[model samples]
Target: MIIKRYRVKSMNEAITRIKYELGREAVIISQRKVRKKGFLGFFSKKILEVTAAVNDPEEKNKYENSSTDSVENFKKVVNDKIRNQKRQSDFNYAQSVNLRSENNEALLKEVHQMKNMLDDMSKKSYDSLGKSKLELKLENMDINKKVIENIMNKVKEIQQDVEEKKKLKMVIGNMIKVEDKVLENAVVLVGPTGVGKTTTIAKIAGKMSLIEKKKVGLITIDTYRIGAVEQLRTYADIMNIPFKVVLNIKDMEKAIDSMKNCDIILIDTTGRSSKNKMQLSELRAFIDRINTKNIHLVISCTTKNRDIDTIVNGYKELNYNNVIITKLDETSTYGSILNIIDAAGKPVSFVTTGQNVPEDIEVMNSQKLTELVLGEDIIC
Candidate 1:
């Protein structure tokens, strides 16, 4: 039987390495407990050691015996090879321990260490004729462990970076403060399809009419959707506000002409997907017709960062003034916010938390945004 001793940082790493090197049939001979390190920032890590034994000797006899040997002779050859293997394995194990004791941590990262030691011991083994070659075996170990260590460190750094990203996502998500927002008496909510643009319009309209006591006029350029008119019509009806439905820029001009006397005109646009360039051009025409007092880009907080970039890029031709971050109540990943503000280069104006008419709207606060990013309690 052969015996070998291996040391590793953890018991799991050690056992996994042992199973990988020797087959599962290998038996452990002994184990030792490592002492703790002393003072001076020194505590020898609690290292564990295990000794394993394996069968050998059958291999040598197999080589010597004839091909037509009887069962008894074959059995003897198998046993001799097994014994020879066991003895060579033990000698290699002893040499590894002696070399390791000479202060060589170069082969100590668990798996690489075993491979290096095995490579040094394997090139000049006994010949197939059961005779020693006595050739040089330890001349060329071409492995550069330093490169491997560098790669391992880089992998660890990437893992830590991913962890930090996940933590930042949790810290700042769904937590923007909605203070009282100052309006220019007019605001345009622009975004891609299904981003709650019209509902956001109604939310702002309800707030303006009920809270600010402004005579809010609702304008819709959304004659495209089947119930787009009805949706705004329903919200305007609930708020007792006047509503206008315009199909094109000429119609928008007429609607503006009709509602020029109103205190605040909230324009509900067609929820065209940002990829539809033709519709975006049409909307650009409508926006250019009116004097931009408060051109706000309404965006969903739940959308991916790339999609937000696409939306921002598609809308940049219109030169919208500020941003409204909507659907904050639906998501918990806020990395998109940094991408939007930094990459899109747009300042945020308001935040919407829910579908409730007026109650869900909130004005943006910079300090509160910082606090949310830090996961700190909001200072009242």
Candidate 2:
């Protein structure tokens, strides 16, 4: 049974509400006249109040069935929503997995391409694994790449069983030329500026004058720089040897004639810039005027391989037969020594180790210099 109350304007209205909502089987149990009042009883209205009751078992069963259907429908909707969300989540995961796989494949492809490119480059550059290793070792010693290439070519011609180091030594022995002769009659030192020619000449002069007691005389054509004449003159004064500063090429012959009484004459020329063709031409003219076979092109060991080539080529017109390496203590790399020797096609006559007079300079030891270039020993 169910009971409900209704407040309406009349009993008819209440009966109509009860019949529509509770069905016609509902019976009115009580009725009363009532008033709906607002605040302070100012807005009040008279209404009819009715109490209704129903006890239909069929209607009760219908209500229970409708509630069960609504609950089942809600559960179905929630389950569908959950299934849809799960499908979307699975799709996203699969997409991420596929993307990673594709990315990995792309990375692998790139790696293989790079490896193939490197392999191709190696095949084109190196003849064999042994040659590659040898080339790398030479490069570490700072030998010029072109020079090393030439060496490798020679190595390729030799028997493989000869052993790499021995083969390298043999090859270097053939390529490198050295003159054990220190000083010759009327020798001239010429090269680019700042290669220590003045000091080198001083050292050589000191050696000949003090140690060898050969009655050495010094002459200079390097009067371009400030105090050039005075510096050599000072050294000459210290050794009490004859010194001459030739202001012009015509004066060179007179200067040489003045030093004719000495056992050996060491001539120092101006350090010319390799780029200055005019200066180099003038130098060539000056050198051509001198009559001597012991013309040595003095170069610094600290000079770069390219610059050494430039300096050597720049002074090629001078017809220098022997080469002198200076500032041996200033650098560790000795490949330039070999490079300059090979490029000039001349023997290395002397190498100056330091600024010390007479002590730091020595005749070129081909075997030891080759070893230094091969990284077997350090230059001290």
Candidate 3:
């Protein structure tokens, strides 16, 4: 084996050098962070030190040839032994053939009986295997007990030939629901802080204004957080839509009246801790004044199922009718999405997979949600 050490400014550079010089088969022996040379190391920069090894090609070739020769010799010996045994067996079988002819009827009957037994056993094993696989998939999904039971029962009602993934998709599609129409006038986005409410609002605003070519208006009641107003205002300016920040019911009413002629008005709300009843109540007061049918509860896909339950319940006063699950790309498991919607019994409106303003957002669909929950490979 040949070993070499590489020191570089970053791990990525070290890895690149190792791969380029040592080939893909090279193994990393050790790695560590080290400081560059400097006077007493006072102002030196940190760097990566990596030790890698690759087998010498000459030695590797020799070993491969030796193993290949041994395998060939073994195969030759086995084949000779088998040929000798076959000649002896054939001679012995010739002597027994006449005697076995008298018992052929009984032997055939026994063979038929054995084949029947094996067929029965195979059928039982196949059914057991399918059930076990289905159970394992459902167990890993972290679905609610009742939901799982319902799905299992539904699956039982399907044809046995249906694929497991198709059955799962059917069950999930029945459980997951999406809004029937695009969001319209006075859509208020509410959620806990750090849940991407502002970003979600911008995504929705951009989609309506840019894609649909609708006359969109942005109204933010998120004046509490520093830069909150500026963030939405910036997005509004980019989208070239009318924007307003209202502090009171009077101001909110005036903003709404000013943008009444617009196709749709997207409202951005200040995110508050769900535990803060006073803040929730204050938010509720503002939403009550809006008197709009479209109140979307924005929640992150990364949030814990328990915290999501609490957040949804806490924001009940807002009476959000729709849900927009954001940050789907950040989380691998989507059971929380099902858990949240199932617990809240609300339909999903839109889903955001990433931070890309309009491109990452999609109108929620039941089949897509099912694919996400069960994993993408399940369908493909």
Task: Choose the strongest candidate by lDDT.
Answer: 2
Give a tens-digit lDDT track for model 2, residues 76-148.
8778877887788778778877887898799889999988977965754455464576788788777888899
**Positional deviation of residue 204's Cα in model 2 after best superposition, in angstroms:** 1.2
* Alpha-carbon runs more than 4 Å astray in model 2: 1-131
For residues 297-332, what per-residue lDDT tens digits would candidate 3 score against the true structure? 999878876787789898887898988888888877
Residue-level error in angstroms, candidate 3, position 9:
99
What TM-score would you give candidate 3 relative to the actual structure?
0.62
Candidate 1: 10-residue stretch with minimal lDDT: 135-144
The top-ranked prediction according to TM-score is 2
Q: Write the per-residue lDDT of candidate 1 for residues 240-359, one digit (tens) a residue.
A: 988998876777778877887888889878766678888888888899887775787778777775677788888886678777877867754443444455445667787788888878
Which window of 10 residues has the lowest lDDT sum in candidate 2?
122-131
Between candidates 2 and 3, which one is better according to lDDT?
Answer: 2
| lDDT-sorted candidate list, best first | 2, 3, 1
Candidate 3 pairs with clashing backbones: none
Error of 2 at 178 (Å): 0.6
**Consecutive 10-residue window with the lowest summed lDDT within model 3:** 123-132
C-alpha lDDT of all candidate models, in order? 0.67, 0.85, 0.83
**Comparing 2 and 3 on TM-score, the stronger one:** 2
Clash counts per candidate, in order, are: 18, 0, 0
